[model samples]
Target: MSSGMQRYTRRTLAREILLILAGLGWLFPLYLLLLTSLKPDSQIFSAPTDLPTSLDVGNYAEAWSSADLGRALFNSMVITGGSVALLIVVGSLSAYTIARRPGRWSAVFYLLFVVGIIVPSQLGLIPLYSMMRSLGLVGSYVGIILLYGGLWIPMAVFLYTGFIRAMPKDYEEAALIDGATPFRTFWRVIFPQLRSVTATVATLCGILVWNDFFTPLIFLSGTDKVPLPLAIYEFVGSVATRWNLVFAGILVALLPVLILFVVAQRQLMRGFSGGIKS
Candidate 1:
């Protein structure tokens, strides 16, 4: 082989080795988590780093029943699903309007949303809690759904607006010329083209909502409406010394989000590539 080809092959081999090492490094913690979870308390401390001799599936059952994970899982699904759906609808419409309109008002509104993304949600936490409590929204599914929707809509709008602005207006114009109403044009012609961005928004916001602990803890604490994160948290606290059970609870909590990412990974990649290309 030529010297240049030999050099190229060596470089590629070195890069592959480095990537493999990095991937293993990242996965080490998860490996530990799985190993520890499969171990009993007696083995967890003694052979902490060793692989399990036998699978301890009881840890999962114990953790699930103790944490009431079934209910928490249901609650998480409701909140995450509801919030993402609301965000897609409102955020897309808002972004579409802003992108299609050319005026100072549109710029101002977009700027406000940008600012919203920058601002910390904690700043208004106390006031928000007080208001929700007064309205008897505290500890309710509707309350948490609305809060998450409002909090995440700004991010969704920012993403959607950028993608929409980069998209061509020909489809929308053609729809309008064909006697379609603005709403119909947006839903039928424009929205269909925004699948990538919508998927991006949904996946991003869905993960955040599903994993969020603080908001649910604040609003839904001491209630049966707690989501997976909070439920896992409470479970951990109760079983603090039992690392095996704690890990089992955590693993259970992680499954749904992991499954979601696995399912949406292709769309997620397309969305990211579309955003960059735009």
Candidate 2:
């Protein structure tokens, strides 16, 4: 018994050591970013990984003003929020229909949405751009929001469908039996039970939309309403990139998404775990 206990304890210690190493590896880049952002231009290349002797915040202020981050922050927030909201409403409704209905057409539609998940958005970029340009939506907030919605709604629907399929139909049936219409039942009875998956969708979609640079770059070019990523890109010049300011801009851009993940992490886990099993 003593030998077995010692072996188990040794294994646990080794596992913990490995985990700590992995965690440090993951955090090393973040540490470097923060450290680099604090150093002056002269100190950056000389001591890239060294801890900053002083907590200089000038880089942050300069990056913010130089990048015009305030307007970019608002643009990103609105676009991300609007896209997630659109996904939740449309994706949930579509998934509910697919899950509850039993027909060849329903299966076909579900298959199409699954195919959408597998297909890359870049495939149709040219045609999509042309269409948006023709519709005069190329530089508009509503256009970008709608574009993100179209790109990500498939993922949202896929998640919702799986969760809803696993769910017992009792609540929905009960609501319908109580004279509630299908739409009303979904809103009142089913959606409340979908809080976990909703968080998952919101977090996943929000992160994607928030960090996406290519779509906004193409669609929102020559416009003042660029997102955070584009604003950060301003620090990257062809001749000389300002490492300190670039790091500061990147750190600033990351804060909102980091806060979002921290807040919704529990729900994200629950959603990934398939929520309440019926």
Candidate 3:
């Protein structure tokens, strides 16, 4: 091989090694959490560094029951799923309209959504809490779903708008020329092309909604309504901490996001690239 090519290969290998090391460094905490969760209470403190000689599945079972993780998981699934679905549907339609027909009204509405992205949700917490209480929505699935949908709309719409603008107009024009209705054209031709963006939005929003702690903590006062993050918070008490159970609860909470990332990683990357290009 040429000397230049050899040097380039060496540099690439070095970069790969560095990235692997960095990835392992980042994952070390998760490994420790997994190890801690698998250990008994006695083993947790005494031999915290020691790898488990044999996996102890009881901690997982205990953690599940103690934290009511099953119920929390269901609640999180319902809220996150509903929020993502609504965001995709609403955000996509809004974005498509804005992209296809950019006028003063569309621009104004889009600007409002852009402004929302800059404003922190914490600023509205007090009013939001009062509003929820007045509406009798606190501790209700519908309340959290609405909050997630509203909070995530700005970013979702922004991403979708960028993606839709990048899409070719030829397909829509052809569909119209072929006697297709506007709705049918968008549904059949335009929407399929947006799969990458849709996956990106869903995965990103799903992760955020799934891992959200503050919203659930403030709104889901009832144990039954608590999502995984809030449910995991219950593992700690006023006087002491249940480290084993806490770690176990964390692992349980992490599983869904991890699985989601793995499944949607390719489309997520594509969507990001498409969004940036757009």
Model 1 misplaced regions, further than 4 Å: 1-7, 276-278
Native-to-model Cα distance after best TM-score fit, residue 204 in candidate 2, in Å: 0.7
Colliding pairs, model 2: none
TM values, all candidates: 0.94, 0.94, 0.93
Please write out the lDDT profile of model 2 over residues 1-278, one tens digit for every residue.
Answer: 79999999999999999999998998889898898989877676766777777777998998888888889999999999999999999999998998899799989998898899899999998999999999999999999999999999888988898899898889889888999999999999999999999999999889999999999989997798899998777656621556888889899999999899989999998896783332
The superposed Cα distance between candidate 1 and the true structure at residue 80, in angstroms, equals: 0.5
lDDT of 3 by residue, 1-278 (tens): 99999999999999999999999999988989999888766676656678876778888888898878898899989999999999999888888888898899989988998899999999999999999899988888888898888899998989899998888899899999999998888889988999999999999999999998998889986648788888777766621455777888889999989998989999999997786554
Ranking by lDDT: 1, 2, 3
Instruction: List residue ranges in candidate 2 displaced over 4 A.
Output: 2-8, 275-278
Worst 10 residues of 2 by lDDT: 233-242
- lDDT for each of the candidates? 0.89, 0.89, 0.87
TM-score of 1: 0.94
